[model samples]
Target: MFAMLVDFASPVSLDWLTLSVIPILFYYFVYTIYSLYFSPLANYPGPFFAKISSWPNFYHSTTGYRHIWIWQCHQKYGDAFRFKPDGVLFNSPSAYRTIYNSRANVKKGKFYEIWPRNTQNINTLTTIDKSAHGRKRRVLNSAFSEKAIRSAAGFVSEHVDRWNEVFLADNDGKEWTSPKNMSKMADYLVFDIMGDLCFGKSFELKEPGENEFRHMPHTIAEYMQFMYPASMITQSPMMKFWVWLKPRGLDSLFESMLPKNIRSYYEFVEANVARRQKEEEVLKRSDAEEGRGRNDLFHYLFNATDELGNPGYNTDELYAEANLLIIAGSDTTATTLVGFWFYITRNLRVYEKLVKEIRTAFDRAEDIQVGTTLSSCNYLQACIDEVLRAAPAGVADLVREVLPGGLEIEGGRLPEGTQLGVAQWSIMHHEESFGDPWTFRPERWIADSSTGVTPEDVARARSAFNPFTIGAGNCVGQKFAMEELLITVARTLWRMDARLVPGDNLGAGSSKLGWGSRDKNHIVLRDAWISIKDGPMVQFRKRVD
Candidate 1:
């Protein structure tokens, strides 16, 4: 009787186990069917798993391979392809204009909100509201205007000279010395420049002793490493429970989950903002009494007024903008500088040509200033352009959402509420737009009658190049950033001779996509929101000539 009872119970347990898994299996079956045939994006071509879920793209993003994967997808699936269930990636230049420029109905997508800021208040970078972004941009434009950049040029030049001095002293009069990583040095120099511009103070990052903000760039990189995955999880229904539990004093739990570096970065910005506010009040009183005020970014923000005389950013907004400025103003310029050095060193011909142009243009390093003769060095400009094209700072998609009426793209009309963006890395490197796209050929940008590059080549390159992005919501600091690059690159190359240390992995490896995609031919970039670059271990010596 006991044995018969045990046999019956085993079958009952088996039935329970089978029933438990049925709902999960059914859900996956439904998801696969909808993703493959029944969904709105069913007609779009993409990896089957990508069509079914956002995880594949998210995983690539987390692994620092998002741009490479997108480029591969573009190669496999044509210009327009689905990268996520609700997202479409474009590789055509026209598609870039249509989505980002024609801002009639579309707006920045929900993906941007994943950037951690004040939950109640969004900054210019993360704001999805078009009108709000426009308003913020208008006020901020005063700080990034031509007059402001020109005013800041003296400050920028001073820092650039100081950086050269630091490098020289570090070498201790050696003919050539390998500083190991130019990337970290570039970060220090740019961070100091940003500190001066944003807070009216220099972090003195290039100086000897420990500086509090010296680790900021690394901290920001570390913080961004987890942000992509965290953002994905934050957007899901699971976050709803956290919100619901907030009233029960669970807010600290969420805050506790934030990385220590991110919190410190916020505190650093907050302190600076508070200090600047105090200084602004004093400056206002001083202006009333002595008729003088500073011209730094904080001063501009504090005094900025819209067309209607509306006050500029509030305290929290100031904090957000200041934080964004630190990252954008520093990291992008630093990344480009690092990539520029890597390419110029790897390609000796390009480096020699650039050095000749810069050296011929400026008799002395002091003469290389923004908006001066340095801008006329066409080859130098071409090298800068090539660097931006080859290794754009922002490697990932800059997504925008389709609005109520839907939107037209290169391939077809995207349905309403669909997210669309150009995969910059893919588009800039597209074979259809550029011949031998992977090659570091700055001559392609130069319209020399002798070089044999046709006007068509120049036109195609112009149409495809958008390192600072395009449209109404493009980078406000574009002019300033270009000026910084022009001055820094020209000055550094003029003062120092640079070459790669023998055995560094930075542009050295087997080719991947093409000859240009070789590990050794191009700077290997790791994307963590912004492209993080490592060693080309360049050795530098003071040029006697």
Candidate 2:
């Protein structure tokens, strides 16, 4: 009797287990069928698993190859392809303009909201609210005004001059310094400059010694790696729970999960903001305040007023805006500078043409200030444009979600709330838009008859090129970026000659990297929203007249 009772109980337990799992499996099977064959996005081509789940997109994002994956999908599936359940990417110039133009009926997707430190730390980049972003943007506009940028040129030149000195420091009177990783060097230089501009004092990360903040770049990169993937997760079908949890407990959980280095970075930013506020107060009280307070970018931000002529930002808002300025101002310029060195060092023709233009435009490096002569260097502009093309600061899509009433793009109407964007890497490399898109060609930007690049051809390229993006959400500090790039490239090339270390391709794509990143000539950038890259180790020597 006991043996018979035990046998019956075991079978009953087994039946219950089977009943629970079967329903789950059945539900998933039905959902997959609907997602692939019956949803509004059914016709969009994508990896089979990506259609069924968002895990594929999340996996690629965490691997830091999301950009290359999208490029590969575009190659196989044509211009428009689904990357996630509700996410579609378009790869054409017209599609880019249609989706991101000022008049577009779309707003930044929920992906942006994942960036702020908490609900209270909203800034220009993380805010999804249109009116709040507009207000914040108006305030930031004063921080990068023409007068402010002109004042900033002096600070930029000082930092660049000092950085050059450090590069040549232990040369031992040799023709060149030992091969320096341009990626690390550029980070140190740009971070120090951003420190000085955003705060009152420089971080001095480039000064070649013990510094508490030397690891800040690495901190920022790691932070981005985690956040970029998490942001993608929010756009998936599973995001319903995530969205519900964020306001309830997830924000605090995220803050707690921050690594020690990230916490240190936040502390550093907070300290700087406090110190700068104190100094601003003192400056406001001084009689010679007109020129007493240094006219750095921070000064402009501190003194800026709102539309109602009130202080533009309160304490919490200032901390948020100031932090964004440092990241945006520093990282973008550093990425471009590193990319410029990598490409120019590899391509001698581009290097020689650009150097000649800079040399001819200015008899002395000091004359390479931000003005008519500097702006007139067409070849210099072209080289910068090419670098931005080949290695954009942000390699991923500028994710935007359709607003109410839906929207039209590339001749197709996307339903409201669908997330879509033009992937920068895929669109810029579109063969139809740019002939020989993989090649590093700067002459394509010029309208010279000698190069057979006509005015129409140049216009066509311009239509596809959006280094700073365009319209309402365009980069506010574009002029500042251009000035800094112009100054850094011109001055560095003038004071020093540089070349890639023999057979050293630290930053170039290798066969081991797989498709869309196997070209030896192409600089490889890992996508973490803003690009993460390494180097083409280079050696530099002081230029001889």
Candidate 3:
């Protein structure tokens, strides 16, 4: 029987290879025709190549030019355009609201789930399950509340003070000292603050001596470099096989690919969470008899309970949240500071005006507290607003999937399973949204008639402004971020006079997309999921009143 089967197989020949190729070609032909002219999204204007394949979008994303590419497409295709066969990019403010509406049934797309925590448990940010996200959000809200932020304010100040000392010591009493890149300095400062808040201790990154976590920022950058391609890879048809083999094959592949420091970072968070849990256990035992305890972000998170007195988060969830807090809290605030310094230093007029505002607003640098006097510095706030507008930290798309019954957008109805979002870089720089959109003018946010900023201009800018985004899933640490920015900026400007290094165009507009430079500065930032800013070297000197 075996010999007979072999004899029969010999008669088939090599013609079957041609048979297999024909169906694949046919399928491609059918898909191209459908996606280009017969699909539900066929009417949407976009590059013909983009409408047929995901490769164009994926290629731009991997090269950190996704934001720039989308912005350019909007320039060609107008406010609404198809960015991928399965996705649409919107440039209008109303479109942003519609896509991210709290009442909408939309859910975060597959992209959010691509990056997994070491524990393999979904955290608030990565969770696509709406009900689970709601539960997590409820518990996490306590950690970022008004009282919680106020409690954490001292940590912010303490770290800032330490950073100042570190900066000055590095200067060695020179009248003018160039530390090169302000971006790394800001990262170290913010990392220390976030370390103290999230881990119940400081990483001491701003200390004079060697620190174990000094490479954290670089490690994070490396980790983010993996995210863009990984996200796109997970969206492919082969992802099913990848997921199936993830437990053994792909898991090891991912683990081996991670930078040593990235692995160490996760290990550090796990250890820190374990240490804090032990401390909380001791504190609970002592609290029953005595009253000795401390209040910080972890304290709030640990004690958070729902209406029924159930704990807000389990052990894995606690680990996940702690990991997220460090990354989100530190990276964003640090990036914003980097952009803020780049702009203000380059634009001497804005710098001098901000300096005057900071010096006049407080008699001493100590008076620059978070909510008290810092909030009153309108010019400082305007500078922050302008920085966020021109060079936002989260420059890429905050993607969401359209739900059943389909969703109504500005242009038309999008079918269910469609992924869409407003590319933040495009919306903020939309010509209709602001006058001289490419220019870094804080006056657009100031509403001053004499400065040529009309109330209408301010209103229009405000409508389009979504630095931290909006709605239910908006940044939980929004207030915390604002407080940190105001205090850090006001205190730094008050104590130091910063001048832009010669021949640096870090803050200048280098791209047709608007703010960041392609040369030295890259102030608008080169997007890699998280924006990567190079340098805006500034010489700093102690202010003499």
Candidate 4:
């Protein structure tokens, strides 16, 4: 039977197997050739290994200090450096205006294409089409308008009670409460608070003064690390080809490699979206009655329609935007305050100054509500802005690619399709940009002659600091996020006495750019998330009062 089968198949064909090998070799040959000659990136200079190959750049990004390395490259080369075969590392301030500021030609890269939800409509960040982004932004614009935000502050204001509870939770009397980490507790409070306001979904992350959830921060840390590689690999046209030919973005195969702590995260926003859709029909019917109130972010978003009068957020759009809100509203602000809190916590002097200012401003924690917390706290706003500039949730120098016509930036010629942008971290730290760039001088934020800072200094200092970004291409949610950060930080300071213990440090995720605020990798020193930020750590016998 074997002989008969072999005969019928005309024996083993080395030809077929050999043909497959040829294509495999040919693909690499083409890759190598283009990587050398025809590739438009051929002339650009980069690390010798990266210019010759893609492995070095991809692997470096995966190793966790990708920001440091990119900063190194920008320092070594001039403003624009070819990071890999396709992606370029830029460190020029003017590059920002060229790429992100100019709206006519550039839109977000398709590298963000994989980010769109398979089950939902495209989100603000994922829309590669300019028209779609414009349309979505227009509809979403009114919700974040000054009037709308002032209205929404009502929801943000309510979370302070929950926050206060966390502060006083386990205080039996002690010093610095055994080294608690503020990041997690702050995150739980922020995430749940934002989730409730945005989707009416209560994650209940905060209880008294502690976080019920541990997985959220770990999940987020993992997700950021996972996405960080894209800045190197996916942004590069060459390496992206290699990855695509194989498997794809984070699937089960990759998820299996992560620690179980990271693996256990629940998609709270996703679950909430599915849960909320049922209520919309009820809301629409109740809309007929005069006193049947239906007003919250969820209601407004759910009821909002497109230009054609179609209801806001078809099921797909609903989930995507809600998921985005969970990410946007919580993560950015939490990250900002975590860094801010870390800085003030370590610098007892700054913390004291902030405390005095906050204490005098609010009669009580309850009175220091969101709107009032932000409005009355001028120094608080300045400190928050300084923190943001020092350690922004995202370093600006946001990239924009010059399309067919090319962009002429800072009066210099940039070829068509040059991907470039300024480095916010570098600029913010430049000795020329900030005096004694390494020191955390919150005094620079205040009007003071003690630091030798003058009115002329303030006027000239504008160029050195561009944290929320400037101009038309700046962050869309800047106003809302700013209000939230200031209120959250000031209110926390007003209620709790945050102080850093000696020998304590921010973990690996922080950038150690000289004099810049510390960025931590976010490991907890002690307690639950909500408890850590509650502060003073039992040092006081009576109370801060």
lDDT of 1 by residue, 257-318 (tens): 86776677677778888998898888787665432555777777888888888778888888
Candidate 2 residue lDDT tens string, 1-545? 87865664597878988899999999998998898998778888988888888899889999999899999999999999888777789998898899888889999998887788777788898888888889989999999898898888998999999988998998742488888988889989988888888987788999988998889998898888888998888888667577667778988998898788788888988999999988898878775547777888878888999999999988898999889888888889999998999999989988888888888788887777988888889889888888889888988898999999999877678888888998888878878877888989999998899899999988888889998888778899888898899899999998888999999979898999889898999999999998898987999988865
Q: What are the TM-scores, per candidate, against the unseen true structure? A: 0.92, 0.96, 0.93, 0.79
How far off is residue 527 in model 4, in Å? 25
**For model 3, how does the per-residue alpha-carbon lDDT over 53-119 read when each residue is reduced to its tens digit?**
8888878877776788888899899988987788888999899989887887588888876666443
**Two-way lDDT contest, 3 vs 4, winner:** 3
Reference-based TM-score, model 4: 0.79
Q: If both were scored by lDDT, which would come out higher, candidate 2 or candidate 3?
A: 2
Model 3 residue runs over 4 Å out of place are: 1-14, 118-120, 171-174, 237-249, 288-291, 506-522
For each candidate, how many residue pairs have backbone atoms clashing (under 3 Å)?
Answer: 5, 1, 2, 17
Residue range 1-545, candidate 4, lDDT tens digits? 87765543442556666777999999978887886677666765677666656577667557644444556666677666666555465554455555556363555554555444342447776776677777776666655666556666656667755665555666653434445555666677778777776767556776643544546755665566666556446556555563353245444455467655544443556566766666767756766662254345665677667788887557777777776777766766776776676667656777777788888887876676556554767667767867766665654335556567655554455556555555565666555456665566766765678767777666445656676665444556678788777667656666566556555654422354331223442322111111112221221121366
Worst 10 residues of 1 by lDDT: 234-243
Instruction: Give candidate 2's TM-score.
Output: 0.96
Rank by TM-score, descending? 2, 3, 1, 4
